[model samples]
Target: MMMTMATAAAVAVEDSTTDDVQPLSTLKMQAAQVAMDSGAVIHASPDVLGKNGEDSAWVTVNVTAPSPSAGHWVALFSPADFGYGLPSYLLVYMFANVSPSFMSSGSGNLRFLVINQRSDYAFGLFSGGKDNPKLIAISNKVSFANSKAPVFPRLSQGKEWNEMAVTWTSGYNINEAYPFVEWKMKGGESSKRTPAGTLTYTRRHLYSYQIGHELPDGTVVWGKSSTFRASPFPGQDSLQRVVVFGDMGIGQRDGSNELAGFQPGAQVTTDRLIKDLPNYDAVFHIGDLSYSNGFLAQWDQFTAQIEPIASKVPYMVASNVVVLCRCSGNHERTYQDTGGFYNGNDSRGECGVPAETYFYVPAENRGKFWYAADHGMFRFCVGDRCFSSVDRKHQPWLVFAAHRPLGYSSNDYYATEGSFSEPMGRTLQGLWQKHRVDLAIYGHVHNYERTCPVYENTCMDGKSKQDKGSYSGAMGGTIHVVAGTGGAKLRDYSAGPSPQWSVVRDKSFGYVKLTATDHSSLRVEFIHSDDGAAHDAFDITRDYKDVLACTVDSCAPHTMAN
Candidate 1:
């Protein structure tokens, strides 16, 4: 295992002419750029790490520079867009002279066992845009003096049905092994465990792991919007009861922890999910699943806290990624402890990595967070507008989820930090409009809000609230909903008359429930997770006459070429 972790990976950038790097036709990650500094050039390549007639398809990572040469070796991930930063770039092995370990591979590469225990890491949502790694360390530390806990989080490939990458965080150098997951039909009895495969997520650096006491100083950097998060499979085709909301605080890492005494929004929601298990099938957390900015423990606490509900229903994550990743305003780079504040990726201790590790034990037995990633929210076309029915299973709707609000939102502090609309929101507005999206969901701003059926940033269909919410028409305008009231600190609508586009807005600890009524009819209601009050709602009747529908068969999940 130690030998495989070292210099066994493939792909190293070489001079334009002759080189030893293998062909790039089939590999998912190929080194495409090499920036030289101080006469020192970086070199590395991948070699199959399979053993005993078995093929794991895994490769070794090789790094090298001329010996006795006057310079430092630096290998940068390429296209300057793959988002390859330290978090995703794990330096498991280093060449002999540049060693940082007690052992070396047969090929002379030093090996690194990055994480040791659950208390030692954290990874955030896909916060590092373009250069976002799958995971990163939030707190890299090992404690023989104190007992610690870990977290579990399994991400859907975000591009395929029933496909997920279940990962565990926190394995010590002494106890090295990856977590395993066993899944079957929701109602099936017993099944064998399926290895979701283990990935060495770490702090981005020459020696990615924490070395004794130095504490990792870089964030992992995986680039470009490679894939989507998780969601339920084929649920779009049936009449499924779904929960929609964002900003479910994982509890504050700062001294004030709502989980200790207060009823956190996530807890309230979990309590409700328990009592009303049959009433829903999945959850769509638009954004802020865990507010574990830098405190990796928060990720552990939040997943453990929501186990009851998330285990049974699919909890989908939006905002973690964007459509096509055209810009950087996805909100992952803001927080001081995580994100771009990661100080050049030297270290991103925990972007929310522990959730994967701590939960794997019991999480394997009790059920874990669920959600599949589907990126078919909108369809863009030029002269002759195009609209495709999304679910071939006769499901007729297109719902969009994001962390930040694109329209009909009261903005305040986020803009100052460059998260609200500088990039993501504005970048998506046109795409949403072009596709004539039906429902748009968000959570970053912590408050519950619903906009009048709107299009082109205008409240085209005005607003009306029957005993249940009602909209004038369906296909013409896109309804925008914000349920950020998920237990974190609440914020007031900006200090001014509510925007005309906003129909119902409230400051409450709640979430929105969406029901796909039929081919042309869908209903959405915002319910306070605290008390069972149906605070707000709206229904859309598919014009059937004009909405373009993308058949489920026609729209395979989105995949990244790189």
Candidate 2:
């Protein structure tokens, strides 16, 4: 199972009352709710109180299927249209990468997995496609409804081409149904069923989102491309381009700027990404992804808005939870403080603990969230060459996506707190240098700034061979970039004097575009969200002098070892 460079693809309501009708409040007392099969129809009634309050309370009328009568509710489209009007590349990618459907209910839970031969990241190929997608977890056929998984699948789950995985969650730990995903590629004749497992997942989950622009002919719908494999071009072995940005808050619907018609920040960015689909292979939403820290629903809207682009490609993401206002910080920041954003321990409780108080960190969040993520990913990306390789995108370049700047970036927020390095707090700074990381991409300051290749507040050695707006990363310093202009409000530079190593800064709504060339060179560009302008561009030449060759024993010569 060898996978090459990843690729990009362009990128859920209820019911009514009837004999199959019931009330949600009944959910509390009844042992269980309706037990229906996939695509089954059921009705629900809302509890209504009248003139006499509790004494005279009455139930809202349940209309027939989709009647929309008082208290009537219905589930549309079987599991509901995850997304539609997708292009071809996206569909193929999903079978190897993401989930096509997810369901759970009191009757039972369903977790469909797309397992394949483990992937060989070196070439992005799998020896065998999975038998049939498996339902890793299921409850019973009675309650065939379930929510989506809680996290996204990691880029390395199916490390072997013969062993990919599609995972989901069940509301209940108990099991009942002999679960399976009976599926076939669209237009094929028969569907097959492969048995699923009932186990607690200690990893990522998947949720569907859509992003598109309205056109006279028709709206190019995109959503279901939630999970997709990373593939190289017909002859190439690396990605040609990838989009990067951060601090994207779901745009508000106002009559001002940042909106294309009624669409706002997130929507605007989504539309841009979709239209430019073929030009880029993947997306890197570094940090501060959804400015919806406080209101989690904003996360829903942001994802839905970006479906057209995200579904078709591998959307890699991280976290940023500082200065997010109280509510937002309450939910998002905990991941950073206690390193347990997803799973909380007694020390942190539901909220997170302070810096040094915990005896031990919880298992779930330990390897996943915040700055700890930096350490985890550092090792993941810088690991071995073949079998145990996690950061398989090792050939062309090594880029890091974090929420805050690790070096000087012309930002003002932390200037008064005594320079940019203080907030960074040493942990990330050390690991980066040790790993010899080439590029550091961040968002948070809301403005874009480019720093000369620098280390320890000093220019390491090289300078761009090209002009200012377009330079070479081959320069001796590590290029520090702040692409915070994704969609959040902009921030001005600190009052006086750009740092000695600061090269350029742009204040606008835009994102980044990266191109990898076969010459072991990486070209980075900043693209505007409003107008597709190349505000900034640069190239970094990667040195693969010692990149090891892969094999069980004997191996071929290294392509990148110069």
Candidate 3:
């Protein structure tokens, strides 16, 4: 997730070594030198794709180069007319050396998993390396059967607990075709239709739906059908499970883009979530989703990667930038003279515009990039750049989440800074303590670590290993959990001795699951994505009275005379 577009002719560089080397960033695209070769021919088969209502399809590319070298490579570009102008998107690239016999045979065949990105595509052969790519061959145009078809339905909870919001991507506008969702209760006799931008829900019933664009001629361009269960009523006492993680970048199934590097465990974790989809009711990908940086097409690849899970559950998201006052990754927000706190060019020319445009959340103002959501007994104050007050009586579990480690983390870089968190992260300490926040979760360190119930650098509870895994009564402080193990290369903990407040640390690719059995108890587990097993876990047993009890600065003042 730590990657971004270059601001100029050179690639953007960051202080951290963990920045993902975006495959698309390797090319000197702006100043590319053209040397079209007649002997070198490039072609892609099954040019017309998505013929079976599929949003994505596999295409085979054949390359014949009279003179090939190790530096030779290929690129996928959209809006096919790459020679006239820069392609709208440089979708993906791979080295010609991938084929074992490519150098000797002067020909190679490669498989690519291409999604319908609302544009036609062309494959280009390059003679020189990424730094001085010389386009030698251009393939014929390839496109989906209906490039404007509505697709990639992403689910999110509406402002109301019983309401579900569905957002999707389509090439059509309201004037071209009316967008709507046709749905029905799983067992209902008749189905009903709701306009695309409207809410659709009824209690916790499972509903099946199809998103489509209704043409003026009464025809329809339908996307894949999917099903989802509505959120339970607010504070409803039931077994509620939630999946939380961060920093998951895109993975290539065909292995075309991995040569330059990508999130190695992204597909594994994505498949795990899909396999375990029946268990969790919702997901909170706190930040760094897609890691598109400024490569716009990668966003489509990321959405298609998570479609199986997002299309089913409420796939909540947050920004990856500074948690307190920022709402997206430095790669999404930081640009020279943009007024972002971080003074850099990590986002190339994009200043949070693409991310804000691509995703939908329950935030009051999408520009603010913060929101409050309720799932049964849990109340989540997600990505609030400012302190947002909440009523904790009904939803007894008050949790706060943001992208960076705003509370605590012994990440080596943060350790060097002596803050144990992103600079200014602890600004929320007063708010969390005053509001009695139970848990504060974060991602961005690219590892898993859980602190003891702690405040102000002190472990408020569980000082002994024997007492570490469980808690009860009026827990005095918030438990900070970092679950940034969603596939980007795992980072190392500080080389120094483990901090006392640090209860557990694991450098595994996994996610955190919080299961609320009832208002009286909560079970938290760190489940490894590989085996789907809980490697670290803890429990909190308390009651409504416990939540009301004073802890540190949590309670209001009272007069003893009373």
* Model 3 per-residue lDDT tens digits across residues 187-207: 974888887454556557888
Candidate 1 wrongly placed segments (more than 4 Å):
1-158, 164-179, 183-190, 197-237, 251-266, 320-332, 335-393, 411-427, 462-468, 472-474, 549-562
Cα-based RMSD of the predictions, in order?
19.2, 19.2, 4.2
Q: How far is 525's C-alpha from truth in model 2 (Å)? A: 0.7
The candidate scoring highest on TM-score is: 3
Off by over 4 Å in 2: 1-229, 232-236, 252-264, 320-331, 335-367, 370-394, 418-422, 425-427, 462-475, 546-562
Q: For candidate 2, lDDT tens digit of each residue in 1-562?
A: 1111110110000111132111111212122223223432322222211122111111111111111112211211111222221111101111111111111122211112111111100001111123211111111111111221111221212222222233321122223222232323334335333334211222222222211112245532111224343334222444456677876655532211113321235556666777887787556665555443232323333444454555455555543322221111122333323432222221122232211111111113322322212111122121112123224244435566555565556676656654463254244544445445567777766788887766667665444424444433234435778887777567688878877777778888889887766536667788888878788887665445422322121233456765
The whole-model lDDT of each prediction reads: 0.41, 0.39, 0.79
Give the per-residue lDDT digits (tens) of candidate 1, residues 1-562.
Answer: 0101100111121111122111111122233222222322222222212122111122222333333211111122211222324333321111233433212321223222221222222111111112322211121111212112122232322234434444323223323433234333323334334433422222111111111111134322111111122333443444556677776655323222224222256566667666776776556665556545343434444554564455444444544334322111122223223333112211123332332333221111112222223422221111111234344234346666655565557655433433233244665555565556667777767778777656555665544443226643334566777777776566666666665666787888887887765555667888877777787766766555445543222223567973
**C-alpha positional error of residue 511 in candidate 3 after TM-score superposition, expressed in Å:** 1.1
In model 3, the runs with Cα more than 4 Å from the true position are: 1-19, 83-88, 320-326, 383-391, 558-562
Residue-level lDDT for 430 in candidate 3: 73
Cα lDDT over the full model 3:
0.79
Error of 3 at 97 (Å): 2.5
